[model samples]
Target chain A: MSVTTRRRFAAVALASVAVLAVTTACGDDGDEGGSDGGQITLTVDVFGEQGFGYEKLYEQYMKDHPNIKIEERGKGMGLGDYNTRLTQWMASGAGAGDIVALEEGTIVQFKAQKQNFVNLADHGAASLESNFLPWKWNDGKAGDQILGLGTDVGSMAICYRKDLFEKAGLPTEREAVAAQWPTWDAFIETGKKFQAKSGKVKFVDAATNTFNSILMQTAGNGTGYTYYDKSDQFVLSSNPDVKSAWDLTVKAIEAKLSAGLQTFSDPWATGFKQDQFAIVTCPAWMTGVIKGNAGDAAAGKWDIAKAPGNGGNWGGSFLSVPKQSKHPKEAAELAKFLTTPEAQLEAFKALGNLPSSPKALEDPTLLASKNDYFSNAPAGEIFGAGAKDFKPVYLGPKNQAVRDAVENALRSIEQGQRKPAEAWDDALKAGEAASK
Target chain B: MTTNTADRTRRGRPAHHAQPPRPRKARGNFGTRLDLKTSPYLYVAPFFVIFLIFQLYPLVYTFWVSLHNQPLGGEGEFVGADNFTALMKDEQFWNSVYNTLGIFVVSTIPQLLIGLYLANALNRKLRGRGFFRMTMAVPIITSTAAVAIIFGQLYNRDFGLANWVLGWFGVESIDWRATKWASWIAISTMVDWRWTGYNTLIYLASMQSIPKDLYESAALDGASARRQFWQITVPMLRPTIIFTVIISTIGGLQLFAEPLMFSSGSGNYTGGTLRQYQTVTMYLFENMFTRFNLGYAATVAWALFLLIVIVAFINYLLTRRIGSAK
Candidate 1:
């Protein structure tokens, strides 16, 4: 209320405003791809509960390239949310990082806009053909351009809790458990046997995870594709692979063998801790997800078994350079370096992401790798032995959307909202609608 | 000191000599006239400029986008109202509209009634009145996302407090996200928890401004407290009630966060397995982000805007007659 006090307050307010303006002005300069003291910052966009496990690699790369600094985005982020954000950035032609990780299911969607990406083959990637598995290297191509480089492949397995197995009076050893079900039909019978003794706990975490595994395995061996063919036609209604997978999943649901949790959802994570389910159809990458969700409390109770079917994959990603990147050449170099056999092995050790490189798969360290979290199960040989021979399946441009549709239909059946026959009809209709 | 005051008062008797002299009028006339004309406009210019850039530009651009075959990467060929025509027959679009209206009715009616009752209780003299009023605002200030997350945990299927409490009542555990009615009730509880306090504050502010003489004369006429409230307070607060009704109408129809966070996982824009509680905003986001149909999403946005306007207008008309029973 006094003149001096008012003057002092006015001066303080002006000073604070001035400070805010200066900081914000500097922030704009720092963020708008500006160089600071000749250093180039390359942002790499990745997605998952844990990213592609490249922290140590980035630090090593920065040490080698003194002028370059590496930053990562989308660690601890879900794939659905990450893909949505990546679509926005690509659509805007700005805000995309120098390098982006494209999952196998989503890469086809981005492949349509091949002009937005820098072809890796043009950046001396053609000579590195022998570094990756043949099918993985081929999956990265759109026409004549190499759109992405192989990072990791998801070798399928069934991760089960040993403590729960003991409780259910089922075989607790990985090999014995795997031998109990050589086919998905046998797998369902074993599930019923476990359900009879387990009392409260069910056999699997969710039907969707099992459904995806069955679909991918069935498609890989039979049609070499699931919802779409090599010609990129929508084949959801006609594909025998889709129907077989659905029928097998419906059988499991009818038996009441599933815990009825949505995969990667909060309840599913809690299901792991609460011991609500005994098994989940886990690919190599999912081991890391299990450890994260199950937490340290569930340290040695889980083990990995060979998946109940022929060799197949569930999740994997590739690294690529966006054409809009300021440092596309450096980004291409980084992408190439990160997919090397050595780098792939590092990621495998950091997270349980099985490498897509045959050389990495053959390494003694990878072949003999025993994960303590899985009660020292042969995590390596189980996922690695068939890694090279696993068939590759072609996913469509709208595969992610259609897969979500099918998954939703499966969940609806598990929730008892729709019957198995009605849900299949819904899945076909939703998949058709989603493909548009 | 008395003599000094007396001398100052004597000097202040002649106001013209005591005050500072005015500047020359003729020389400053043109400058004064220019300031009078331009200064007022300058003071109000910033708001209009911001509104034009942020509001008007998006409104027009959305309409333009709705007419095109826009994909995620960029604009596609203009197809001229094809998106709107498709939306008319789309079952999913209508499903989302049904959900938004269902949630709005379930949440808003109870919220306003409880808010009015709370306002009336607080308007009276009570012990610890300040503490009670302050606590009423605590839910309002808490972020909606945080509230939804906590409530989401409480409603978790296997181990949530809600299910545990249900067990005590000899009832079966409910999967809140599985059914339409269950998801609606769960989301409605979240909406009411967050916004009831806000409505209470608004109602209480207006209640304090009502003239006291009407209540006093009503009591003098041997009217009971309940009768006084119905006869005097309700009629006088018509405009305030209408204002709250219209505001709630706009907010309720545009519901986004609570339902989106209700399922508590990735890709929850679908709201549930069967899209049980997907609001119009969630559908718009799902079309844009999940389905990558930008033109369709733009059409959905425009349609949602029109819906809110229509619903709010209906609310205005209905509430205008609330106190006309006399």
Candidate 2:
């Protein structure tokens, strides 16, 4: 090569070395819990856009307590990635949260390692128990110890488009719809009727929602099983109630009541907005989803009725102080304050997250409140009625996996990939794997 | 010009003699030899140091962790080989293995064939060649997560452009995520989309380096385009093909992001409606993250390592045999 060419090559090599040096210098140093000034750097982790509304709430809280400042760390949506990120942070001795949010399904998993979280029973939550529904309260309890405090009660109710129901010549009023389908069988029949009327629309979002709502109500428990008779060996597999629920799901798909869109998808959201489905089994938290997605076009066109089955609790969250927390007392105080009837009521007004506290249900504010999002429906009154009746149930450590397994099995049947019996067997297999 | 070049060469030769560059001592000192021996190593040492710290140490630690029952966040027991034993008996693990191998075979074969074809097509003089090369790399440069999301939307049963196009043939909209095989097709489409261009570029590079004389000779021997490809091009490109195959196989088998993101926005991690699209890497991720079973996940990672090693070894042997036989 010529001398100039060689010189150019050498210069390029030096530039490449410089680039590499710059990248290495910029690599993360793995710092945690850095605070600026008097403000505490509380790394509040939530999934998806959950922190958006909570950001507003925190702003209000900061206004009241200007001395205490908070920072938020939002991660991936749903339980899977959320659990993963939380576990990683805690495992690295990063001390994840002073006041951490725990999904209803994740509470048992977190409580399994009690040392990872502070027992909220120590933080005066024991007295607060009487304020919450038994089931919502037990979500944060392990054995006799309370590790988290419930922020919201996810009481299941069927959300139906009033306009769609009216067009179908079915009852558009909440009370009438609630009375029209006291049982799941009648509900499916009503769905058939609704489908016959609306040529383009479906009766429900998917078969799984219909099946799970009934399952949760009839079982009257958190884990979706009433009881295990022998040595308490957890009779989820052969439970007749669960079997019936599974069968009902398959039947719904066969009967064409379901829209066939996977739940929580973009299509499902569109279905909600367009009222493609006549009924949706919405938990209290779903009020936020409905209001956010359904838009003004759906305003005053929807109302909540009793879910086909009796009142069933579906989803709720808890806030807990981990034992590794530097300021456990302050954390516990924060957790306690977050779940208090007053605070929960405020959250309910802002986000449509029903307060788990029963006292919050009886509050004049709850009784008087109306949602402009749901055709100005008195949503609080409707949800509060069911929220009062939620019976507490046991959720074992493997609850999330078990629920997923059952959901998958039911989905197989619903999607016509397997026969009902084969689906049942699949469920058993999945449950076995999950429980192991 | 010739006279000037000659004068420059003469000056360069005489200048070397006139300068008598200062290196006078020839000493047989141990320190000098040590310095000579170590200096070259020191110059190239960073890679080894980085490889040892980041790659080798983590792999060794992962192996150690695999031997125990380490749950997420460090609550575990030392259950020697129990995780491996459990994995052996685990049906989900076996299912994931089947899915991974299935995806690997399904994705890599088409990717290689299409890449080779595209490389051949592009090797010929063509219009907008620069733009075509740039277009080919666009997919590879795009984020995997973003690719998955776009493909997910395209594969949507209700309103996807794919299903809309299929409607031209009077085909029904397939619930891509609802069935196992359909989900595999969707995921394979994603994998093929991202890496086909990359493999094509590799093939094109190798193809460009092949001498024109070989093809000219083949044409002189009454060879057609087809014959030239099979006889001269294929044989000469064997090593590049092998390299591409091995790389593609490793990537295809470790397919996680496409399936994970395709199956995102759902409550379950079955990969698809029936758990049909769940690759082994996804299984490992689920074990570690979703189930909080880190020891089991580590075992899974080790098993995956062994799998890759065995497959790669077999591939290497096959390639060597082909090369040697030729």
Candidate 3:
């Protein structure tokens, strides 16, 4: 080709490249000002069944406020994936939902990076503080700023098959059954008795939940019953509560009280239906899972009792408006509305997520309600009492990793892969390594 | 022109007919002219540009990140070779490397043998030829996640088909995820199940191209079918075998999804309770995502890259030596 033609071709290519670059650069400014006709779409990212009640809540909210549109994105893979995605979005400073749900496990990690979320106190969240439980409300607070609003609290309870208990010659009544195990030692003894009589079925679904329940109970016990201290130093190795919990879990494993299944696993769910195990360490939210897994055939066979030892909290979540949100005010308002007493009560009734709001707990309808799935057990009373005693555990940035390490130790013992002492050493080492 | 005349005189051919080449005019469209010059590069530029942006940039950036102490959401501090130094002392890192190699060996050997056997069977004159060839690709088409989940159930301690089948022969049930060897075996079974059929197709494609006369001569020499296969088919399949080995080695070193899925369905990427089956990729994922240690994760990535390069080089040397010996 001649020089003129080559030069013309180069010019055309350069012009096209410049056009592409300009368009691409323009495309990246995001949907910050994309709203048309004063209408805004707020995206809410959540994980698992925790987001179950939001669709109805969003529909109701949209009906009330026509100018606002809410879009929900859910990851059913559970909290690990949800937290990873949230962290990634936060790190990239883009693609984060207007509002994101943070589980109790990872909320502190997000709270540590306080700038990632908008201070809801600046957007009228402080006025609603009296509506929520003090600990649940405080759990969402970083210093004077509220980063999130409490949604649900997972208060501990013992879910057992009444018929299975009867077969095992144990007390079938909720109060009597709860009376049999006031402490963990008593709980272990009761498990022994049940197993001695009922050879076919184990006492608990999995020892891992028992370990977690004990850990939760001991975590906020005012002593150094924590993985991290107030200064966020690793104290897992020196924590007596952790050691005691490990010992108790080891004892349970040694006694063969566990059905040797992982919680939420397919086998564990199937075991629930087949009555392979008589009991499970149920938090308030687990009642829903149990009911779903048990189906209609096992309907009133299951009952709820007070959890062994002092009360503990399992899973809970908070809703936070990200700083990247286009409409922070609207997102905060939606978050506030979702955690309101009325909304919490409705959610409790529909989804079995125990209310985090103190006023919702005071509501006579919720307090008097019985779960027919749990043999008409007064679940409200049991979980409410548990929630009342729920002390706020100061979870460190690596709480989930630490918890996994401890739980992995318990699992190894349960699987007969390691002795308790070796597992304990392994847990401490792993916990320290992970925390670092 | 002088060189051409000299060459024609040396060959004692007709020098008059060997005239200087005529100048050809630019013909066809702009595409033909462009192809003759440098413009063909423009056609392939998109792929190279994309590769540079996506693959090459991340790789170089990963090496840069490895020199820092970056935590998620925290501004990384420059730490020089500290991350690599820590990796050297990290037991989990070495454990992962060991697990990866163990899984690779267990998976690859059985996969190659079974694939070779299947390919030989498929290359014969058989009924339902098309159907059998198509069936060989079924496993390759299935998603790895689905395969992992299905295999997890089949390897479950109390309820798996494997344990039940063993029970019939009076063998005890094995907790596949609890022990190192058992976990390796379970993960290997998953890897082999997915890739054996794919490798079989590869081998069969190469096997079909081999001259039929070689096998016929062996048959005429009174060699047994098995002997002829060993003598002729195996020798001709060396190149394809080497290619599969390299491919499988690369794939096995980067094994991630099966073990991750096999461990727990709820996104626990530790590989197992004890991390008995945690391959190197899973370890990197655990460090990067779970622990939020980006710097260390990047170090692991670099280590994995170096390991792959070294292994691939050794494979090349071994194959070349074998080819030369033949």
Candidate 4:
């Protein structure tokens, strides 16, 4: 062969190999991963164990449309790993799933990176906005445009040990427990009574956990400030409601109402099993955690009660289509299916993630569902009622840090490193410092 | 044939000098040397090429990001040096700095000291020396996550083996994650458990390399084992000790997985109930992931880099002084 022709052939072969290598690195979801006729595969990444189940849902959806297949990836929970993994994926603009789950605290930051997610309004997501409650629906809104759709609404409730309550002579009946605490003062008095009767068993997890949740539910989440507003500031320091919450918590500690176990630690779970703690202030997802940790010892030994004062929401998640997704339609359809009333209810049964769909709240399947884990407490009815009255709170990107700082300050008081007054100052200082 | 030879001479090299055919080929080889240098670069360029694209590029990109105000997921505007300025004013950052340093001192010091002592003990004519040496390394091979989980269970306040053991000693139940000191203890236990064995092996390796004649000379001079350890053993292990210190410092400063697992409770990412145990890496992670503040997180990473550089510098100075003094 001529030298020039031989060189050309070698160059072509090298080019082909390089192209193959690039394609291999990008990964494949089988040409049929998407439901649409496009060869591109759509993936939706969500956090928690629910990601596993979503894969099945994706497969089911793909069965109907052979051309479109989905690759579902689960990014582990908490704001730490969630942001890092998602950020890396988003930056790559290739590996990012078609749908990405953005948590409440992270939504603002994700919204700021407007290029990462596809504007659903552009892809017929506008009509679905009205399906959710105004506040719940507004969580994913950066402005007029919606960045995500809420998949679950975490309405807060008190999950107490029925056996512990029974032993403490506090009413184990949900009605009786609900009636006992009409106000925050009444709740503190009840806590004192429970402590007096139960001795060393802690009435709740930690002063910080109890105080923060009460502050949110009673005063409403970030009532004094919105993160977006420059004028909005952390009022947990000077706010009377926050002060009262702190005061009440201190009084509980002084009264020796808690077992003093670290919240979310191995000991904490063991405490639940041993019936060492009476009450756990939980949101929607915590119900599953309670059952998982307590095992059979807690079966038929737990009951649900209204959160003290008023109901406030804690955690909920959202799924959005990234702008870089190859098949936007298939991605949206998959997102919609995963969050549909039937699917959400099934997920609720599988995991205690409360459904975001308002229609699902009225579904008889949910209402009739009884958890053998919580002493056969009507899971659907109790969570559904709270879900209805629950209001969505504004969570800023700095919310997690603020929460951490406040918790640290509270720990200072618990450990006797600082007094409540000093801890309050520290918390405010830390929060302000973090905000900057 | 004469015409072909003339053509070959012209194509292979300039024939200004009339020489043997072998000499002409040798002169042509000089040209091939230049081509080898150029062409080999093309053939073996992928490693350097890929390294620049993936590793070096991201590192430089991170430095670029550090200079800007990037939020989580790259949404924020570039506010030059604002994040750095904010970091300076931020107490949490400073607090984290203290936590990082404090953890380094608390965990790394005891770890090295105990490792040296254990390595010395095992070096003697003892029974089951091989068995003991192998057993010492078991902790080193164990996963950090698994160690953290196991220790988390042990540190449990209600029914933990630790608290139960403490109960036998008339000690009251102490909440491990409630206080900063106790949380550090919990975190340090995990650190100490995982790293002490690895350090011991290094110390032992250095110890085995020490000449027996030196120890004999020390003994002949009537130096006791303790005296020998102080003078002969310690002085000889200086270089190894310096190496271990640097390793421990870098590892210590970047202490993330242990404390993170402790905080998350479920091995998730929440920084414990109190966040008393949260480190700088955890804070950076939280900022980047939980908060989606990429700019803030990048700022944290750069600060960590500077801190690590400063730490490594200080360690080098200290080690150099110690080495010279010994």
True contacts kept of 1: 0.59
In candidate 4, what are the lDDT values of residues B8-110, reduced to their tens digit?
A: 9887876545565454477779888888789889887899999999988987888788777665455458788888998898766787788778878889889
Off by over 4 Å in 1: A1-37, B1-32
**Location of the lowest summed lDDT over 10 successive residues in candidate 1 chain B:** B16-25
Between which residue pairs do clashes occur in model 1?
Answer: none
User: What is the clash count for each candidate, in the order shown?
Assistant: 0, 2, 0, 21
User: In candidate 2, which residue pairs clash?
Assistant: A131-A358, A300-A375
Tens digits of per-residue lDDT, candidate 4, A1-436, equal: 6999999999999999999877654544444443333445677777753342454566677776666657766644544455567778776676777888887766765666776677777767788865676677887777777788888877878888877788888788988898998876787789988887887677887666676677666555445333223234555456665666667777766666655555565666677777677788877777877777788756887788777666677677888888887777768777777777777777787776778788888889888987777777777777778777765555555666666666666666766667767777877776665564
Runs in model 3 deviating more than 4 A are A1-36, B1-36, B265-267, B321-326
> What ordering of candidates by lDDT runs from best to worst?
1, 3, 2, 4
1 or 2, greater by TM-score: 1
- TM agreement with the true structure for every prediction: 0.92, 0.88, 0.90, 0.83
Query: lDDT of each structure?
Result: 0.90, 0.77, 0.85, 0.74
Best by lDDT: 1
Q: Write the per-residue lDDT of candidate 2 for residues B1-326, one digit (tens) a residue.
A: 99999999997899678887676457756677789999999988999999999999999999989988887655678999999998998889989989988888788889889998999989999998888877889999999979987898898777788899999999998888877678878888899999999999999999999999999988999999998887777778999988987897688778888988886556445676567888889888777766678888899999998998888777777766543454
Interface RMSD of each: 1.5, 2.1, 2.1, 4.0
- Per-residue alpha-carbon lDDT of candidate 1 for residues A67-145, written as tens digits (9 for 90 to 100): 6789999998889889888988998889999999999987888888899999998899999989998889988989889
- State candidate 4's DockQ: 0.29
Candidate 3, residue B9: lDDT? 85
Task: Residues B1-326, candidate 1: write the lDDT tens digits.
Answer: 99999999888877877778777589798998899999999999999999999999999999999999888775488999899999999999999999999999999999999998898899889899999999999998899879988998889988999999999999899999999999999999999998898888888899899998878888889999888777877787889889999889899999999999888665588889889999999999988987788899999999999999999999988888877978
